[model samples]
Target: MKRFIALIFALSLFPLSAHACGADTDCALGDRTYRIQMPDTAGDKPAALIFAHGYKGSARGTMRNKSLAALAERLGVALVAPDAIMDDWSIPNAPGQSTSPDVDEIAYFDALKEALISKHNIDPDRIVVAGFSAGGMMVWNLLCARPDDYAGFIPIAGTFWAPEPTSCDTPAANIIHIHGTSDTIVPLTGRPIAETHQGDVNKTVAMYIANGGYSASDSPDMTPDLSCESWRSEQEATMTKCLHDGGHSFKADHIKAAWKTLMSGN
Candidate 1:
């Protein structure tokens, strides 16, 4: 989805199965709706990628990226993208506007994951979650709420507003944060969301590092187009931040880079 004014936003290969979905499907979670795609192989217990689209974007809008489809093929994981009720996520309360649904989004997400696991026999340990922009903020909230629920997290061009949680419910998972140095919408330096303030990208990373109990060490790995850095604590957790030259947009290369980095171990 293109970055339009207000809003913005997996891994693993399990075995091949005989009952995979060849195309996308319109799935429902009580009153909410989402789009899901299964691999051609009928691999039960396959890995899953749950994607949250940018604000005001639909599941179909997110799937239009093409890279996500390519990602499913590349990683052999089922792809699922859920739509937000108000075309905005329920992060911080926007002035004169409600970003998310009146319902419990956390519970919605939980049900979504459980539905996939039960229907497809997905591997709970291999489920990875990712979001962009507002969706990315959702990922941050998810991390704070259920850090142990996923194997990996990728928040692209995302941030959290003031009143964000200072700690997570459990140990953090492997995380890779990708952002653009030139983004003004959700700038790396941070911006105000309604009456609250979002932290800078660097500060956001530092917060995640602190939660994971990892200390910053070694200089950032640099390249012509990107600056990549990581904070690690032995085998406990690893967090990587990548800043590129693009604006607030999700490039195909970004998805590819995230998949490569997060799926490197499995």
Candidate 2:
């Protein structure tokens, strides 16, 4: 009966699936909405990469990156891009215009996960969240505050905000932190802004490692575009840090490299 219905719909020259969103359309949910693009040949329950936009960036802006779209298609994964409430993630202690601290950011991600699984036919266990700069900070906070939510994290050139976290939760999943060695905007050692400070990126990763009890992998390996250091308990989890020789800039290639390194072991 299902096939018959689908055949009838197909014969009508219209796609059976309803309202699929891409670079041009928005997937509205609650008061928020995100944009998504699935690979042309995506398999059943294909993996997804939730790429958060950087500071003051929007979902439409993220979707407009053709390279990112191509990368997702080449990897055969769904690309999910979400927007911040006000051009900035309302993280507590993070510099933003919000008068009230955001408790919705976490909830928003939870909603996104549910939406992906129920609506998109994506693999629940293979969703990896990644971000650049301020969005990268959001990735860290998500992993730190909610360790059990996603399969992995990839944070590029960002870390915690002022009043650095003393600890993060356990059951820490895999992480691939990418950064630029010459970053002065969000330095490795971190820099101060007004009354707040950008927490050291190294310190943030170190805390996760110590808290998660991940052991270093014995042998070292390198990728084509970037140099990386790794730590892992292969039976359970992995944490890797990759660095390039650039400044506080970003490219889809950085996330592509991180995605390769993260999925290689899993």
TM-scores, one per candidate: 0.82, 0.87
Best by lDDT: 2
Cα deviation of 228, candidate 1, in Å? 1.1
lDDT of 1 at 227: 78
lDDT (Cα, tens digit) per residue for candidate 2, span 99-206: 146357989999999999998898998888998888888888888877777778988899889677888877877888888999999999889877678898788778
In order, candidate lDDTs are 0.73, 0.82
With a 3 Å backbone cut-off (N, CA, C), the pairs that clash in candidate 2 are none
- Model 1 Cα shift for residue 255 (angstroms): 2.0
Question: Candidate 1 lDDT (Cα, whole model)?
Answer: 0.73
Candidate 1 residue-wise lDDT, 107-195, digit = tens: 88898889888876888888878899888888877777877788888888987765455666657677778899889888987787666
* lDDT (C-alpha) at residue 248 in model 1: 90
> How high is the lDDT of residue 10 in model 2?
83
